[model samples]
Each structure stands twice: as C-alpha cells, then as structure tokens.
Target: MTSLTLTRGATDTRTARATGRRTAWVPTLVLILGALYCLVPIAWVVIAATKSRSELFSTFTFAPGSGLLDNLHDLSTYRDGIYWQWMANSAFYAGLGALLSATVSAAGGYALGRFAFRGREFVFKLMLAGVLVPGIVLAVPQYLLMSELDLADSYWSMLLPSILSPYGVYLMRVYASAAVPAELLEAARMDGAGEFRIFTRIAVPMMMPGLITVFLFQFVGIWNNFLLPYVMLADDTKFPLTLGLYTLLAQGASQPALYTLVIMGCLLAVLPLIGLFLVIQRFWSLDLLSGSIKS
Candidate 1:
C-alpha cells in the first residue's frame, strides 16, 4: 500500500511538470503570433515597394521584384521632387515641435513634481484630464481658434498645436517625482544656486530619460499627424508626409500607376522613423546606464 501511494505521488508530480511546460509555451506562442501579425504587413510593404507597377499585381505577394531603383527614381522625379519636400516638411514639424514640447513638459513637470503650492493638485488634475481628451475631439476647435488668429494654411498652424503635449507633461511629472530627489534640490539651494540654474544643470540631466521619452512620443505624433494639418493647410507645398501620402493615395484611385508610387512612398516614409528609433535608442540606453550607476 505504501509503494502504491508513492507511485501515485510520483505520477502526479510528472503530470504537473508536463502541464507547466505546456502552459509556458502558450505565452511564447501568443507572442510569436502577435509579432508576426504586426511584422507581416511591414514585410509586404517592403516587398511590394520593390515591384514595378505591372508586377505589383501580377507577381506573387511576397516575391521580390527588380524595380526598386526605378520606383525610387520615379518617386523622386515625380512632379519636381515633391516627395522630398513632404519629407522635409515632416522633419521640420516633428523636430521643432518635439523640442519645444519637451522643454515645456520638463518645466511643467518639474514644477508640479517638486513644488508645494496652492492649486498645484488642481492644475495637475486638469492636465491629466487634458491627457484623457482625445486630440481628434479638439481638432475642430483648434482649427477654429487658429482661423480666428488668421494663421490657417500656414506652417504655424501645423506646429502651434503640437508644441503642447499633456501626456508628455504627465509622463515627465511622474518621472520627476520619482527620479529627482527633494534632498538634492535643497542642497542646491543651500549652495546659492538659482532655480533656473538648478533646473538646467541638475534636474535636467536626472530627468533625461523621461525627456527623451516625451520628445520621441511628441515627434512621432507630429510626424504622423493628419487631421490637424488637413483641417489647417490647403497647400500641398506645406503638407507633411501623412497628408502628402494621402494626396498621392487619392490621386492613385484615378490613376492606377500612382499606386506603385504610393507603395514606394510608404516604404520610404518608414525609414526616418526607423532611423530615429535606432539613433535615440542609443542615447536612451546610455541615459539608463548612467542613471543606474548614479543610483
């Protein structure tokens, strides 16, 4: 009877082990499927961009074609290189807007995180509410406001709305609260440092990671923004990549050959974002490492 009991316990242990191993695989399989789901479309765009207009529909979906150079040459030369103009516009909007947003966010967040004052909670809560309100909901109101100021259909219209990011402020606030020590600020004050000096010299470095996060988020948001620019700008000369590509797509509906250009444009559009991530990721890593060491 004791032998029988021991044998049953061993069998249960083996069963549990097998079940755990199978359970572990479930999450792994799910992750793999999720990755493929996201990656397959990107892969399709890359492959399709290589095909010429004829091969775009005639060739196999995943097959590589030999027209990548031709597509690029055509896209570049199309309508006096307007594609590059769109690229430049997008870069300017995203770059300058993100920089300004990050600066404002850092200042607002540092103040909210470090200071004790009247209505501080109220202000932070208001900003949090702003974060919850979708940008789409505010687009029309923003357009009306810009129009009242007579700034519609200009670069200012594209940029002015992007310079303030409630989400970026919220993120920086949380990060500053945790990352910037009150004791350090006290020490700086004791050493006769001005508030501005303390912020620029001391607090900024400590909050670098959060700032970078905010910058990247704001940059991507402005880069991919469509509705705000669509509502504001009528000129193709000032349109960012999103609206510019959209115009190409609209034209493509009538002229089927433009579809190839659209595909090629999409592939090129993805390159800047990829390069930005790769470049910023290095700084992000270094900041994290420095932070860990400082801690």
Candidate 2:
C-alpha cells in the first residue's frame, strides 16, 4: 500500500510539472508578440534612414539602402550644421534641468519624509497635483507667464520650467522614507551634524539609486519635450532635438529630400538616451524596481 501511494504521488507531480510548462507558453508568446510590435517601428526607422531620397520611396521599406553617409553629410551641412546645435541644446536642457530637478526633489522629498511639520503633507500633496496636470494645459499659461517676465523665446524659458518635476519629488519622497533610517538621522543629530550635512553625507548616498532613477526620468522628459519648447523659443538655434526634427519634418512635406535628414536625425537622437541608460542602469537597483524596497 505504501509503495503504491508513492508511485501515484510521483506521477501526479510529474503531470503537474508538464501542465505548468504548457500553460506558461501562452503568456511567453504574448509577451514576444508585444515586444516585436514595439520594436518593429524602431527597426523600420533604422532601415529607412539608410536610404537615399530616390531610394526611400523606390526601395522596399525594410531593405537597407546605400546612402547612409550621404544622408548624414546632407544633415550635417543643412543650415550650417544646425542639427548638431539642436543636439547640444537638448543635452544642455535635459542634463542641467534633470540635475537641478533631482537636487530640488531630493531636498523636498527628504524634508517631507524625515520631518514632522505643519502642513507638510498638504505641501507635498499640492506639489504632487502638478503631476496629474497635463503639460498641454499648463503650456499656454506658462508661456504667458514667461512672456510677462520678458523671458520668452529664451533658453531660460525652457530650462526653468523643467527644473521642478513633481514626479521626481514624489519618487524621492517615497524612496527617502523607506531607504533612510530615522535612527541614522538621530545619531547624526546627536553628533552635532547640521541638517544639510546629514542629508549630504548620509541620505544622499543611501538614496543614490532612487535619485538616479528620478534624474533619468526627468532627463528623458526634458529631452523629449516638444510643445513647451515650441511655445517658448522662437529661434531655431534654441530648439532642442524634438523641435528641430519637427521643423525638419514640416519642411520635408514640401521638399521630400528633408525626410531622409529627419529619419537620420531621429536615429542619431536616440543614441544619447541609450548611452545614458547604459551608464545609469547600474545605479538603479533591480531590487528597487521589484518593489522589494519599501518605506
């Protein structure tokens, strides 16, 4: 009787294992299909950029064309190499805006997380409301405000607005609350350390992973932002990559030659973001992403 019972249990376990493998294939297949759907467009753009003007319309969409160098040369020479200028502008705005935004977020979030003050929650909630507000709704008013300040059509107009990200603050707030220990702060306080020193020496390092995540997000937002910069800056020289590519596309409607340049410009534009992610991926811990880190 014991031998028979053991045999039946082993058979059941093997059957369950087989069933689990069969059931898992469906979700795996679905995920693969979703991934392809997203990546196909990017693949098309990369292939499309290689084609010359004549070949762009003439060749098969996926077929690689021979004018990669030629297209790059045309893009570089277009309007005295203005494309490079736009790339630089994007880097400046995203880099500086993200840095300042991250700093402000860290401070605000740390304060909200560590301190018990009057209306602290209210202040944090009010700032968080900014995240729910769409950028489009704020753009016109922001433009008007900047215009009134005589800062419209300038770099400051774009840079200043991007430096206060509510989401960044929220992320830092949550992260600081969890990642930083009250005991550590108390110890520092007992040792006669200033608030700023405690934050810089202890909080910042412990919160580095979260802060890097916030910085990457803010940087991407500022980099890809089009409508804000469009409404603010009138000069092409001040235009970021998004606006620059947009203007190029508008021109391409009349002059199809510019389409190749637009495609090439897009391919070039993504490289910086990819590089940024590769550099910062190490700092953004997988454990944090998995929701294992809690406040």
Candidate 3:
C-alpha cells in the first residue's frame, strides 16, 4: 500500500508540471500578439520613409524603396532647413522643462513624503487634483494668463507651464516614501543636518531612478506635445517638431513632393528618443533594481 501511494503522488506531480507549462504559453502568445500590434505602425513608418514620391504610391506598402538618401536631402533642404530649427526648439523645451520639472518634483515629493506640516495633506491633495485636470481645459485660461503677463507667443509661455507637473510630484512622493528610510533621516537630523541638506545629500541620490523616470516622462510629453505649444506660440519659427511636422503635413497635401520630406522628418524625430532609451536603459535598470532591493 505504501509503494502504491508513493507512485500515485509522483504521477500527480508530473501532471501538475505539465499543466503549468501549457498554461504559460497562453500569456506568452498574447504578449507576442500585443507586441506585433504596437510595432506594425512603427514598421510602416520606417518603410514609408524610404520611398520616393513616385514610388511611395506605386510600390507595395512593405516593400523597400531606393530614395532614402534623396528623401533625407530634400527634408534637410526644405524651407531653408527650418526643420532643423524646429528640432532644436523641441530639444530645448524638453531638456529644460524636464530638468526643471524633475527638480520641482524631487523637492516637493521629498517634503510631502518625509516632513509633516500643517497643510501637508491639503497641499498633496491639491496637487493630486491638478493631475485630474485636463490640459485642454486649461489651455485657453493659460493662454489668457500668459497674455496678461505679456509673455504670450514666447518661449516663456511654453517653459513656465511645463515646469510644474503634478504627476511627477506624485511619482516622486511614492518613490521617496519607499526608497528613503525614516531611520536614516532621523539620524541625519540628529547629526545637525538641515532638511534641505538631508534631502540633497541622502534622499536625491537614493531616489535617482524615480527622478530619472520622472524626467524621461516629462521630456517625452513636452517633446511630443502639440496643443500647448500650438496655443502658446503664434510664430512658426518657435514651433517644436510636432507643430513643425503638422505644418509640413498640411503643406504636403497641396505639394505632394513635400510628403517625402515629412516622412524623413518623422524618421529623424524618432531616432533621438530611441537613442535616449538605449543609452539610459543600463543606468535606469541598475538604479531601479538597487532601489527596489533597498526598499
């Protein structure tokens, strides 16, 4: 009877393992389908950007064309290279705005996460509310407010509003609460360190992963944003890449030759973001892992 029971248990275990292996394929297949869905458009754009004006319509959708260099040259030469200026403006806005936003998020998050004050919850709730407010709802009011300050149609209008991000604050707060130890802060306080010093020296370094994530989020949002910049600036020269690309697409409707330029411009726009991810992934992963372990 004992020998028969032992054989039965081994058979049951083997059956369970087989079932688990089969179930795993379900999620793997779903993930693969999701990845293909997302990648399809990007793949289409890359292939479309390679075609000449004539070949763009003539060739099969996925077929490679021979005008990649020619398209790039045309885009570079378009409107006296104004596209380059738009690219510069995008880089400037995203770079500066995200840096400022990250700084503000770190400070605000640290305070909200660590310090207890009279209006702490109230302030945190208010910021949380700001996150619920849509950008479109505020666009007109923001424009009017900027106009009142005589800053409309200028870089200030764009930069000032982009600096304060409620979501960034929220993310930072959560990260700080987890990544930073209360014991460490208390010990620092006992050693005569000021709040600001404790934050800068201890909290910020430990919270680097969260901060970088916030910066990257802000950067991508600012860089890809069309509505805010469209409403804020009246001058074409100050347009970011998104706005510039829209303008290019509009012109391409009348002059089909500009289609190739628009496609090439889009390809160029995508490269920086891809490169940023590739370069930062190593640091981002290590820091995130270390932070998770510490927490």
Candidate 4:
C-alpha cells in the first residue's frame, strides 16, 4: 500500500510538470509569432532597399542586393533632392508641433488635474469626447477651417492642427493626478510661490515622464500623419515625408526605377524614429527609476 501511494504521487508530479511546460509554450509561441509578423515587413523593406531596379523584381524577397548606394544617389538627385526637403518639413512639423503640443498639454492637464473651478469636469469630459472622435473625421473640417483662415497649403496648416492634441491633454491629466502630490502644491503655496512658478518648477519636473510620453506620441503621429497633410498642402515642396513617399509610389507605377528609390526612402525614414526611441528610452527609464527611488 505505501509503495503504491508513493508511485501515484510521483506520477502526478510528473504530469503537473509536463502540463506547466505545455502552458508556458503557448504564450511563448504566440510572442514569437507576433514578433515575426512585425519583423517580416521591416526585413523585406531593408532587403528590397538594397536591390537595384532590376534586382528588386528578380531577387528573392529575403535576399539582399548591392544597389543601396546607387538607390541613395538616385533618391538624392531625384527632383533636385526634394526628398530631403520632405524630410526637413516632416522634422519641422513633428519637432515643433510636438513641443508646442506637449507644452499646451502639460498646462491644460495640470489645470484640469489640480484645480477646481466651474464646469471643470464638463470641460474634461468634452475633451475626452474629442479623443474618441477620430482625427480622420476632423481632417476635412480642419482643412476647410484652414482655408477660411487663409492658412491652407501653409506650414501653419499642419502645425496648428497638431498643437492641440486632446489625447495628450488626457494622458497628462491622468499622469498628473497620480504623479503630482497635493501636499507639494500646498507647500509651494505656503512658500508664496505663484501659480506659474509652481507649475513650471514643481509640477513640470514631477510630470516629466508623462510629458516625454506625450511628446513621443505627438512626434510620431505628426511624422506619420498622412490624411491631414494630404488635405492641407498642395505644394509638393511643403509636403511631409508621408505624402512625398506616396508621390514617389504613385510615380513608381510608371517609372519602375522610382520603386527602388521609394523602398530606400522608406528604409531611411524609419531610421529617425528608431533613433529617437532608443535615445528617449534611456531618459524615460531614468526618470521612472528616479521617481521610484524618490518615492
């Protein structure tokens, strides 16, 4: 009887261990599949970018070619290097727009989070509604409004619309409520710190992580924004990289050589966002770490 009981216990233990391993593999397999799904397209772009016009069509999807430098040269010389102009325009739109948006979001969020005033909840709820409404839904109306202001086809057309991100404001508000303490504001007030000083000095520092998050979101959104820029700008010189790359693709239908340039352009365009993420990730991690340490 004792030997039978021990044997049964050992069998059950082995069964449990085998079940655990199987369950663990389910998520592991899913994650591996997800990674491959995302990476395959990027890999294809990198490989295609290396190919020349002839090689792009002839080579295997994963195989690399030797025309990267030629493709770069062609892209640079195309339309007297308007691609660089598009890049610069995209950088400007994203950089300045994100900075301004983050600033506005910080101010607006801090006010909504910390202050008590008439219809404050109403205003916040209204902003939340704005967040729910897709940007595409607003694009045509924004274009028409820009036209009314005589700002259409101008940089301001892009910058102005981007400056007020409802989502950014919402993010900051949530972050501030959690991150900034009421006691700190009271202490600052007791020290006779003005509202502006308290916000700029105390609130902003406390909310750096959220601010960085909002900045990155807005930066990427503005950089990749297509419909807004397409609707707003007519001048190709003022076009952002998205619209510009689109034009390249459109022309590629007729001029097959432009296909290689377009692929190379996509490869180049991805570099800045990747670099930004890597650089900002360090600061973001440090800020979170410092916040944890302080707490």
Candidate 5:
C-alpha cells in the first residue's frame, strides 16, 4: 500500500509538469504566428524594393534584383530632391508637435489629476470627448477654421492643430494620478514652493516615463498624419513624407518606373520611427501602459 501511494504521487507531479509546459507553449505559439503575419509584409517590401521596374511584376514574388541603389538615386533626383525636403518637413512637424504636445499633456493632466479645483472632472471629461471626435470629420472643420485665421496651407496649419491631442492628455492624467503621491505635493506646498515649480520639479520627474509615453504617441501620430497635411498644404515643398510617398505611388500607377522609388521611399520613411523605438524602448516605462504602475 505504501509503495502504491508513492507511485501515484510521482505520477501526479509529472502530470502537473507536463500541463505547465503545454500552457507555456500556447503563448509562444501565438507570438510566433503573430510575428510571422507582420514580418511577411515587411520582408516582401524589402525584397520588392530591391527589384527593377520590369522585375516588380514579372519576377518571382521573393526574387531579388540589383537596382536598389539606382532606384534610390532616381528618387533622390526626382524634382530636384523634393522628397528629401518633404522628409525634413515631416521631421520638424513631428518633432516639434510631439515635444509641445507632451509638455501640454504633462501640465494639463497633472493639474487635473492633482488639484481639487471645481469642474476639474467635468473639464477632463469634456476634453476626453475630443478623442471620439472622428479625425476625418474634424479635419474639414479644422481646415476651414485655419483658413478663417489665414493660417491654412502653411506650417502653422499642420503644427498648431496637431499639438492638442486628447488621448495624450488622457494618458498623462492617468499616469499622473497613479504615479504622483499627494503627500509629495503637500510637502512642496509646505516649503512654500510655487505650484508650477513643484509641478515642474517634483511632479515632472516622477511623471517622466508617462511624458515619454505621451511624446511617443504624439510623435508617431504626427509623423504618420496625412489628411491634415493633405488638406492644409498644397505645395509639394511643404508635404510630409507620407504625402510625398503617396504622390509618388499615385504617379507610379501611371509610370511603373516610379514604383521602385515609392517602395524605396517607403522603406526610408519608416527608418526614423523604427530607430526611435529601438533606442527609447529600454528607457520607456511600459508598466505605465496598463496604468497604475505600483509605487
């Protein structure tokens, strides 16, 4: 009887270990499948960019060609390198808008999160409603409003409106509430530190990770933004990389030679964001993404 009981216990432990291994594999399998789905397109683009104009449609799907550098050169020389200018413009708008948006979100959210002002909750909810305001619906009205102010088809047309992101404000507020402690504010108050000073000094540091989150979201949005700039800017010189590549592709429909250039340009356009993510991910507090990171 003793021998039989020991044998059963050993079998139970083996079953538990096997069950754990199976559970671990479920997520691993899902992740590998997801990765394959995403990477297939990216790999296709890389291989597509390498092909020559005739090879784009005629060659095997994954076959390589030797025209990558030549295509890049052709794109560079197109319209005296207007594409590069578009890239610089995109960098300026996205970088500046993201920085300012992060600043505004950090301040606005910290105020709403920390202060006990009347109507604070109401104001926050109202601002969050802006998130639901569809981008397409708002873009037309925003364009008209900018035109009324004589700001349409210019840098301000793109820069000013892009900076006020409702989602960034919401994110900052949530992070500020969770990451910042009330007692710290009270201590700052006891020191007779001005409200803004305390916020800028004590609160901002604690909220740095959240601010990075706001910055990245706004940056990527502005970088990828097409409709706002499309409606706002008519001049090719002022267009962002998205608009430029689109125009290239639009022309590609008529001129197959432009296809390689568009694909190469698309590849170039993605590099900055990819580099930014790779560099910043280590510093980013992904814990804040789910909200309420433990103090």
Candidate 6:
C-alpha cells in the first residue's frame, strides 16, 4: 500500500492546531466552568448590593433592586464614612508596600540571577524556606517587634512589615533568571555603566513585567490579609478594608443591620483591584511571567 500527501507550513500549522483544539475541549470546558463557579459569588455580591435589606432576603436572590443609591448613602454615612477611610488605608498600604517589595525583590533577585557570591545558594535556600513558614507565625513576632519599637497599632506597623514578601522575591528570581540575559549585563558593564546604572537602565525594564505581577500579587495578598493587620492595628481609623470588614461582620453578628452594610462593603472592596488591573495591564510585560523553577 502507498499513501500520497501534500502539506504546506501554513496549512500544516493550522491543521495541527485544529487537531489540538479538538482534543482540548474537555479541559477547556472544565476551566470555563471553574471560572464561572468562582465568579458567581462576585456576581451575587454585585446584585445583592443593588437590593435593599428587605429585597436582599425577600426578592429573588439574584434580582437587581432599587436600593443601590440608598446603600451607597448609608455606607457613606456609616460612622461618618469610616468605610472610605478603611478603603484609603488599604490602598496606601497595598500600593506602597507592593512598590517597595517589588523594588527590593527586583534588586535581590537580579543580583542572585546574574551573579554568584559567597553563600548565595545558602541565602537563597533560606529565603525559599521562609516562604514555607506561614504568615501566622510571623504575625505574633512582627507584632511584638512593632510593639517594642512603639510602632504597634499604627499604619507604619502594617506598611513596614508588609514590604518584605518571600513570594515576591521568589517570583522575581524566577522572572529575572529567565527574562534577563546575562549577555546584556556584561554588555552594559562593557559600556562603562555602573552596576546600579545597568540595573536601573537595562535589567529593570526587562524585568518590569515580572515586577508588576509581583507587585499585584503582594498588593492583593496585603489587601486580603486579615490576621497580621488584625493583630497589629487597634484603631478603627487605621484599619484596612479587610480588617475593617471583619470588624463590621463581627458587629453584624449582634446587630443585623450591619449585614446589608457588610455586603455593600464587600462589593466596594473589590473595585479597587479590578480598576488597578485594568490600568496596570497596559503597562505590564506579561511575557516575563512565563517560565520554570530549577530543581
């Protein structure tokens, strides 16, 4: 038996991709269903925020009601609009802490990626080990240290400790190793650029995509975190949205009026991250995020 076939690069590529897609449908559907499951709560919160307290429980659960403005007004007037204060506090801590953590991670990761120094492996391994230690363990000691320095129950206490992220460091290390070529660093050195200059001019730009991811990761982690801020902060005025919401929910256990407010607050808390992602997407280099960890 004999077979005759004709193929071209463009046609072969198209056919091969088509065949692959035919095999990928099951996994793709599963992923889409998982995404929908995750997004359903978010949808419910949005719809719930639009409803009045009575509508929230009485009306069809997902039906939109006419209470959006009233909810907003109540939230705005609640405790003299302390909810907005909590929101601003979260933004400050997450934004500033993420920026600093990204910078620190970029510096530390770039150095380890491009250069070998005494005890480099030991230090990197120790840092990787730190990532295994849960945030809970650090919360108590970090609180105690902040108290020792008279920084406890303060914004600085939250902002300062949040800036050191082991995961951000690891992400940057992976990103820098893959995205940055050692040749470029050597070329920059050959061009008489100082280490700092090479880093600022060359390495930073190349690693920006990874850095933005690191920043966003850290920002979201800090934004969602409850325990550390809960332990460190005492003043309602200094509380981030997450901690503030926890307090609000705790109060709601005794006073049911706060239930509506908590739902609306949850709706409001999600907007900043969504808005940030949209804004940062245009500037972020996502190509750097694709790579592997060494064994």
| TM-score for each predicted model, relative to the true structure | 0.94, 0.94, 0.95, 0.94, 0.91, 0.89
Please provide, for model 5 over 1-295, each residue's C-alpha lDDT reduced to its tens digit, 9 standing for 90 to 100: 9999999999999999999998998999999999999988888888888888888878667877888888889989999999899999999999999999999999899998988899998999998899889788988999999999999989999999978888888988998998899998998899899998999998998888888888888889999999999899998899999998999889978888888899888888888999989866866745455345444
Candidate 1 lands at a TM-score of: 0.94
Clashing pairs in 4: none
Worst 10 residues of 6 by lDDT: 286-295
CA lDDT for candidate 2: 0.92
lDDT of 1 by residue, 1-295 (tens): 9999999999999999999998999899999999999999999999999999899978677879999999999999999999999999999999999999999999999999999999999999999999999999999999999999999999999889998899989899999999999999999999999999999999999999999999999999999998999999999999999999999999987899888999999999999999999999999999999988988
Instruction: Provide backbone clash counts, one per model.
Output: 0, 1, 0, 0, 0, 0
Give the Å shift of residue 94 in candidate 4. 0.6
* 240: Cα error in model 5, Å: 0.4
> lDDT per prediction?
0.94, 0.92, 0.92, 0.95, 0.89, 0.87
Pairs clashing within candidate 1: none
Higher-scoring candidate on lDDT, 4 or 5: 4
Candidate 3 displacement at residue 28 in angstroms: 1.4
Model 3, residue pairs in steric clash: none
Provide the clash count, candidate 4.
0
What are the candidates' C-alpha RMSDs?
A: 2.8, 2.7, 1.6, 2.7, 3.1, 4.6
Model 6 lDDT per residue over 1-295, tens place: 1232344666788999999999999999999999999999999999988988888877667778899999889989999999999999999999998999999999988887788999988878888998999999889999999999999988889889878777778888888898889887888898899999999998887888888888989999988989988899888899999989989899988988787899999999999989988878866534433323211
Candidate 6 to truth, TM: 0.89
Candidate 5, superposed: residue stretches over 4 Å from native: 1-13, 285-295
- List runs of model 3 lying over 4 Å from the truth: 1-4, 289-295
Residue-level lDDT tens digits of model 4 in 1-295: 9999999999999999999988998899999999999999999999888888888887576777889899999999999999999999999999999999999999999999999999999999999999999999999999999999999999999999999999999999998999999999999999999999999999999999999999999999999999999999999999999999999999988988889989999999999999999999999999999999999
Error of 2 at 147 (Å): 0.7
Stretches off by above 4 angstroms in model 1 are 1-19
